[model samples]
Target chain A: MVLSQKLHEAFKGTVERITSHRTVSAFKEKGVLSVTEFIIAGDNLVSKCPTWSWESGEPSKRKPYLPAEKQFLITRNVPCLRRAASVEEEYEAAGGEVLLDNEDNDGWLATHGKPRETKEDEEDNLPSMDSLEIGKKNSIQSIPSYFGGEEDEDIPDMAEYEEPDNLIETDPATLQSTYLVAHEPDDDNILRTRTYDVSITYDKYYQTPRVWLTGYDESRMLLRPELVLEDVSQDHARKTVTIEDHPHLPGKHASVHPCRHGAVMKKIIDVLMSRGVEPEVDKYLFLFLKFVASVIPTIEYDYTMDFDLGSSSR
Target chain B: MADASEKKPILQFAPFQSVVDEGFWHRLSSLKLNKLGIDDSPVPISGFYAPCSHAQVSNHLTLLSESLPTEASEQAACTSSVSLGNRNKCSVPGTIYNTNTLEGYHALDKQSLLKAEAKKIWDDIHSGKALEDSAALSRFLIISFADLKKWNFYYWFAFPALVLEPAATLVGIKPASQWLSPEEAEYLSAACREWRNSNLTADVPFFLVSIASDSSATIRHLKDWEACKGNGHKLLFGFYDPCHLPHNPGWPLRNYLTLIFIKWNIRRIHFLCYRENRGFADMGLSLVGEALISVPEVWKDLNSVPNAVGWEYNMGKKGSKCVNLAKAMDPTKLAIAAA
Candidate 1:
């Protein structure tokens, strides 16, 4: 038994080394991104998605290899309106429709089901509001369904979203500001929900973007690790999502373990290639975020907008 | 007037929960080893908190790596800039009294230290310094003995809140959405959002909300209280509440209440417990309440500092908290554990 265990360990090391090599040089062949590609993808993501900005984090904790000002990509205060289980329940109630490539993974990648209904398909099926009276409510409610269908298309900048009525003229000393008011829900469902500060750091060991989540409860209080786990998909909650010291930030955050990130990403790339869509390294974060969305289905970060070009949605 | 049953309940507040990040401990350990050798002087640190965003969770006064003084001559420079427009992290000035030994920590007069800190807050309120920089009203202190060798830390945090004799009575409290009309809620929400988004007022925890006769609301800094008065508009003393309890405000409000009572001499004050959801003002989570304070004779004296009580509860008990970061922080221990 000991000998078998040793053999298994040695085999695992060999596989890891081989995978690492492939990830290092073959960003096009394999889905994994190199350090430079990660930065390039990050810059593109930040430039495209105003919500996703570069953060230097703590000066001492900043990775020496990475750029000083751009150690990681962070998008703070992303509202998680519902728990993953609730979203899953909604899907199951809607109809137990399976949309992911692999059925064996259970409902892990079931998040794709909603975004799978392409923006064009949604526009074709759902009628636009004929009345401006319902425009604001409809626009806010349909934020999740709104996805950028093309890579080149600009993601709707939620940060800059301002209602004319909500705009206030400030004193000349301060700049004009518009606040996004969290409106009371039309439905009786509790408007209070958790928010997550989602950040992505390039994991050198895994050669993939590592996603970290710092969740706050409806009252803006920090969620403990166990509390954060409730939002994570059951398939990955304990297995992959472990609370670790954030590389840049001061506190421990729930990070999706990147050990199998390369393998899973490679599978996704292969599936994309089979669909005759040539995925590029610059769009790696988009695809990476899509996979991460599978793990955390409720964090409404700015990832849903950019993945429509290279991947086949249901 | 009604009978004795009509008396309103005394207003209580949820105390601030101190959450020291592991990175804070790591930095403290480094500072203890490298810079602060045998010197156990009070090191000025910063604490960060935002208005409560969750309905059931109280936002912690978190100490991060940035909280500590970056340089060796940190003694001269404790008061840091509070103009950081990061809506999520409003800076609270704090000082850490690190003791050389556990005995020294225990023997330290907790009452005197707490009293001295409360005096500073009292002085700030009276001297009008807190009006200019509202973060001064939320000053905090920590007494710690960092066991560098074992990587263990024994610490107790105190957010000194000045008490008001005959504690403020709650007249009525409810969700802002319930209290304000639809138009009023919408207007107030927008006004609050603008205030939070601005670089100058984002970190200012306390402010005045002036609602015009036309249902439009404008948020002004506390320093502009005189300017905001007698404008023939409704006024609310608004603060960034760190508490999520439906009924009570946070610890910051205790001192804030004292400040209000002393500064403005307002007896019945309508206050806004400004909470947010997803970085925007949520009227459902935000609370609008009225606090009626019966000023004590002692408060009449400008030189007097009222008694305070704000020791943070540790593990649901009234005590100090200890952290054992040796497993995670010690390099030798980490290597050995790895081996």
Candidate 2:
């Protein structure tokens, strides 16, 4: 049978095993409900497997591969709050006054000693028909009528309503013109967090998918040639990688020299094809993850697990 | 000088010019005390005023320092300036000072004169003529700004160098420019589009829009966004602000969002704000569920939103206290019901 046919068969069987009711039930029993949980759990399982081992670096060493740093993990995209001040701090800075002491004062009774005029009496005292017509024609003419009319004796001096200059004393600091600085010390460590754009392109010369890394520094600035030296392993940097100006990216990026990736990929493809798997460009990432699981068990490369299974309509 | 060849380039400092009133300085000093409760002595009256200047000279200085080698290669580099191509042509000056005119000595607009002097200092530093003058120049700039009541600008310029001094010593170079270059922006936009297209399904037709400094690019993206409206596909606006200067992203992002929200009447938007070239450093994913007439104090956190499953696993241990868009938009939730 053809290699494709064999790979198709193998892929079908694997998919079946992954989605089986028994496997699902077992996973649930083990308290693993999500794909991420399953993958993480699988990492532990794969690590203990006798067939799996770290293949890179020195063969004489027992565990040559460096342990994964927490910082290197590309888990989630968190919001950069590098310079964001807390809302409370901002409010306080904006001169917001919080009333701590609130004592209800009913001073209206003392201010007006006599009982107020009844609504009925006030209505009766309102301007009559002749005066009302004149008031409508010229609104300004009615102002004097109220000032010197029957209610004139009740009207208090205008000085009583005048607002004091210092009614609510404002701090001089609040009035000061404050200017913003160009940059702040990225105290949140947001600037130091590194992220890389990894691309695998076919190198026709070697007939393999060569990995290229465009590293971004904490500030999201492209890593200069010197900065790229920091992220890569010394051996890889010296022998297998070349730092050059990126054809597309303006800045210099580090590209790993063609290694065993093509041979490994071809071998995996052959194995899958022998099990009846068809050639699929889309399945490359999935296949890569499965193949590398044996060597790099702890690598979190599966993004499909991030999908919401319940919302499969998407 | 004992040896003319070994003589140092004469460094000149701008004369002191106090523009603002002494009373204003006193008020500013007192205001600082009132705000921070740290009583500060009033700034001396005899300091020079430094205006907010452009970064062109610094950028050129950085380029020159990077390209040219000092010591034995200085003569060779100067000769090769002619062959270094058209890029270097504009930078090469006939003379450091215009000897024909009294432009340097008699210029009355102190700000412009000081800016020219600063540029000359940077040029000298890049040329290896004034190697040890950086500390003195920095001090001069700081004192000048402090006296001028422009401590904000002083802190912005001086703080980074102070904090990164140790690292800079090890690296033997100043910190690289923080902002994304135009080329990097283009590459990033293409990369994001490719990623979105590859991952997109019929049910989840994710759209990636790249925003840059150009207004036309933004408008073009908006047009594309409008076309996707009511198509059942979710709109994911990828905002890339090329402004790498400090305190820039907030205002620029706010302005861009304001323009788009008002023009399109977009009730809700899912945005990823990022810097270019930095694959994902300082990148944030947020959802603004309301018609943002003005920029909000805090954008809705991505992890808190429903169907935003990819990022939940990586939530900080303290757990994000950001305003949850999913909860905020739900009508059933009385706490965030629309007013």
Candidate 3:
């Protein structure tokens, strides 16, 4: 496709290429366009125009002509260093013309292909990379996911998880003082507090919670279904168990809550959400949206995350 | 958001019916179980067994022993139980995998062995190997002794399948709730089709081929089904009416499911109502179609039963009664009713 001068000027100074691959050049004029190499420093980094191409190869079948306009170097936004660079690049590349990682501001829609909204306006639009795309060399992955929004929400309906009352070492005074203690464990707090040492935040779509459930969610890479709170519903007695279909689940059928899965999910969501450990599980949770006949479609997914709540691996 | 109310779940604590171990156990006691087409003796046949061949039968048991798993081998070795006069030779080891009977049946090698046994069995009528001891029994035994042996074997397997997984086990309640197996379903379907075309009912009266214990409950349930014999062939795995209980444990859930199903599925149905009120209450159960409230005496008689009709309210179960099946269905399905 031929790029008009106006388009060229638009990308002139911003585009940067770290590795010289002629194939990745933003503009292809008989496939020989220049590739640019760029590595930006911090959060203040913005997309500038692609002005030059970095050269580094013997052009052949094994080695290709370097594209000057395509090379762009950026920094890591995750917990570690060099890995964050790769994640940010992947997020940007994955978003491409139609940003899958786009944040909601008037529910940002891509017109024709390119992003309609500016990246600056959408604060929740953090370039988050998924777990599968994590390159072997880039192990320093980002823990911060969209679920735990970088910006605060309007009226956070998100339930703030508190350690269950039983897990906490409250003096008798506290117990006597409040009748409405949320989590009162049945057994001693010792083992009660010693959970599986992991937390997970799942978007509405990623539910069947393959962890500790009858089946697996094939779409996700997180195969070992976690016995996190969401897969189980907490009862008034502070005991959390796998909630089953009302007609079948034998003992106590939770079917009365037709949205029992969602409701139970909400309780687990309340916990990891309080802390900002939201992992990006948007793809899994989003599919379930159609089944939720009633929830308004306008509610933009909280960029916070789809499923990110990971924990200190024991 | 339009309203905060949309978030709450519409249904709460859906009505659930639980069959405690005691309830199912006591109820299943009266069921012949064989009525479900389950085999009593699940024999693992292998060798030259005729429908009446003693040598082949003995070889089969020897194989049954030889293939037993280590644990089971020791158990069988200790008891050393014997049958078909080969008791001493029945000490062959066995494994869990030894029971695959299909290979032996299909093997060309065994067909000759079976034909030989069949030939010898056709020659002798009083050899004592003939099961059921009848002249025509050869026809029954000849068709597929292997299948009969296997079915009988499974029928016998039910003894353990019934006991080892006693109704007390959480899974056993399934047999109580759903006594019909896929096999039984096939039998009923075939039987119905066959009867639809023939005059089998007139040749033999539609009296139940059902068997029950001499236990009081079994006798009472058998009598209830017999009274309902009416003018057609109806088979029922009989259990006493709940009212027959000494303490009258309200209405029995199993019989309630059973009686209602029979009325709805089988033609020419007429079941004697034990407790008019309880029966009416059962009619309220959706699994069972509506009871003929058309009979005013049935309703009037129900007046005598305690906690009968309106009893579902005390127990948190939905009125899935045949009369209320509509209420039991999704509103969407109700909108488009079928013919």
The best candidate by DockQ is: 1
Which regions of candidate 3 deviate over 4 angstroms? A1-314, B1-103, B108-339
Docking quality of model 2: it rates as incorrect
| Residue A111 miss distance in model 3 (angstroms) | 4.5
Fnat per candidate, as a fraction, reads 0.06, 0.01, 0.00
* Best of the two (1, 3) by lDDT: 1
| Candidate 1 per-residue lDDT over residues A168-227, each given as its tens digit | 211121111110113323454333366677899987656788999976554333455556
Put down candidate 2 lDDT per residue, B1-339, tens digits, no spaces. Answer: 123234322211111111111122223333343442332322211111111111110011111111222224224333332212121011212111111112222222333333443444334433433222212222212111121222111110110011110010110111112223445444544554343223121011112444343411221233354455564543444433322332222111322332234345453444433332212223222111111122232322212211100001001110111111122112343232222
Where is model 1 chain A poorest over a 10-residue stretch in terms of lDDT? A171-180
Off by over 4 Å in 2: A1-191, A233-237, A244-252, A271-282, A285-314, B1-253, B256-285, B289-339
Lowest lDDT block of 10, candidate 2 chain B: B159-168
DockQ of each: 0.06, 0.02, 0.01
Count the clashes in each prediction.
8, 17, 90
DockQ of 3: 0.01
In candidate 2, residue A238 scores what lDDT? 45
Candidate number achieving the greatest lDDT relative to the actual structure: 1
